[model samples]
Target: MQYKLPVSVLVVIYTLDFEVLLLERADHPGSWQSVTGSQDEGESLRETAVREVFEETGLDANHYGLVDWQVQNIYEIYAKWQHRYAPGTRHNTEHVFGLELPCVLPVQLSPREHLSYKWLPWQEAAGLVFSPSNREAILQLPAREKARG
Candidate 1:
């Protein structure tokens, strides 16, 4: 079995107006989040972000504003998902990114990875994400946008 790399990317896809796109997990229904995935060997974090966004939402990230937030979070892998990494690998490092779209657009989710998708106000989206890191990223959207501008 191929074990996943211990590095990943978390991409918060949102609009200039603060509407965020979230995907409901297929494996764990009701758990909604932005585009996220583990990095493959030889892939940079930015590449991981773009690939994950495409895989999860069918959005061409390059056509929009994809920014690496220059933030990293090291966290314990969820107990149920630890097996996806090498044996005894309990932690993963996740790089943060943001994909700024002009507006909310329909998404085609990878059925195996996500069950559904939605566009919600940043606050509501932040409140609904299952991961604290994801929530924090969404919460920072306003400040991040201001800084970008």
Candidate 2:
């Protein structure tokens, strides 16, 4: 079995007005979050962000403004998911990114990865995520955007 890397990326997909895109997990019903996935060997963090966004939402990150927030969050891996990592891997470091779309377009979700998708206000999206790191990233969306401007 192939173990996943301890590094990953969390991508916040949003519009100019702060409507963030979130996905309901197929594995954990009712658990919603932004695009996220483990980084593949030899892939850059930015590449991981773009690939995860496409895999989760079917949105091509290349066409949008994909920004690396340059922020990293280290957290304990969920007990249920720790098996996917190598033995003794108890933590993960997630790099944050933002993909700004012009509007809220319909997305084609990978059925195996997500059950559904929603576009909500940043505040609402932040509240819906299960992971604290993901929530914090969504909560900072407005401030990040303002800083980008």
Candidate 3:
């Protein structure tokens, strides 16, 4: 089996009105997060974001307003999930991106990965996410897109 790379992307998908999308993990029921996945060899960060968003939520990030947040977070891999990475891999560097939509929309979740999806107010979404970085990113969404208006 191929071990995952240490680099990954965390995409905060939100609507113009700040309804953020969160998905419940199939592996960890009730634990929710935004779109995320590791970078494949030969893929740029934007490419990773687009691929992951589509794979996780059936959304073509390219068709919407996708933007790099120009920020990243480095955090230790959870003990429960560290096995997916190479032995001795302890942390991951997550590049941040934002995908904007007109409003909350239906999502097609991958049953093997995610169990359910929901669009919540940014603040509520932030509180509901299991990852600190994902939560913080959600909390910052409104400010990050303030000028987009």
Task: Write model 2 residue lDDT over 1-149, tens digit each, in one string.
Answer: 99999999999999999999999999999999999999999999989988898888888999999989889999999999999999999999999998999999999999999999999999999998998988998899888777767
Give candidate 2's whole-model lDDT.
0.92
lDDT of each: 0.93, 0.92, 0.93
Tens-digit lDDT string for candidate 3 (1-149): 89999999999999988999999999999999999999998999999999999999898998999999989999999998888999999999999999999988899999999999988999899989989999899988777777665
Question: In model 3, what are the clashing residue pairs, if there are any?
Answer: none
Better of 1 and 2 by TM-score: 1
Off by over 4 Å in 3: 147-149
Once fitted onto the true fold, the runs of candidate 2 whose alpha carbons sit more than 4 angstroms away are none
Cα lDDT tens digits, model 1, 1-149, are 99999999999999989999999999999999989999999998888898999988898999999999999999999999988989989999999999999988999999999999999999999999999999999999999878777
lDDT of 3 at 115: 93
User: Best-fitting candidate, measured by TM-score?
Assistant: 1
* Per-candidate alpha-carbon RMSD to the true structure: 0.6, 0.8, 1.0
Better of 1 and 3 by lDDT: 1
How well does candidate 3 match the true structure, expressed as C-alpha RMSD?
1.0
TM-score of 2: 0.97
lDDT of residue 62 for candidate 2: 98
Best of the candidates, lDDT: 1
Candidate 1 has an lDDT of 0.93
Better of 1 and 3 by TM-score: 1
